[model samples]
Target: LKGQIHGGVAQGLGQALMERVVYDRQSGQNLTGSFMDYSMPRADTMPDMEIFSNPVPTKRNPLGAKGAGEAGTVGALPAVVNAVLDALAPLGVKTFDMPATSERIWQAIEEARA
Candidate 1:
């Protein structure tokens, strides 16, 4: 269960911070067609996670076990994005897009200053 959640979180983090589809505008070719061109989450990029499980059995289920599938992935994207936005709130950055790359964050800061 813990491994599942961790894996999901890693996937979510990638989506939130690194995953992007790039294309060559002139040729309409997919630029990010390979792992070498595409950015993905690495071991060093992942934050230390502490997961606390509180199991609540459903009355409908005989074992009362709930599905944990995709739970981590579902929660991670918004949580990471919101956290970044919250950090930038004081800088007048009111909104930001997904895959909050370093370049994008810097752009947001510059825009806020402007």
Candidate 2:
């Protein structure tokens, strides 16, 4: 369960911060056709996570257990995005898009300042 949660969170982090599919505007060709052109989350990029499980009995299930599949991933993406927005709130950065790359962040900051 722990491994599943951790892996899901890693996947979520990648989607939220690093994963983007780029295409050529003129030719409609895929720009990020391979791993070399794509970015994924590495071990060094992952944040330390502390997980706590609160098991609640489900009335609909005979086992009284709720599935934890994709639980971490489902929350992780928005959590990370919200965290970044919160950090930049003081800078008047009210909105941001996905794959919150450093370049995009800098652009947001600059726009806010302007």
Pick by TM-score: which candidate is best?
1
**Model 1 lDDT vs. the true structure?**
0.88
- Residue 85 error, candidate 1, Å: 0.8
lDDT of each: 0.88, 0.88
lDDT for each residue of candidate 2 in 1-114, tens digit (9 for 90 to 100): 666788789989988898999999999999999989999987787788887877778899788866677777898899999999999999999987789999889999999999
TM-score of each: 0.80, 0.79
Put down candidate 1 lDDT per residue, 44-83, tens digits, no spaces. Answer: 8778889989777789978876667767899889899999
Q: How far in Å is the alpha carbon of 42 misplaced in model 2?
A: 3.2
Any residue pairs clashing in model 1, and if so which? 57-64
Error of 1 at 105 (Å): 1.0
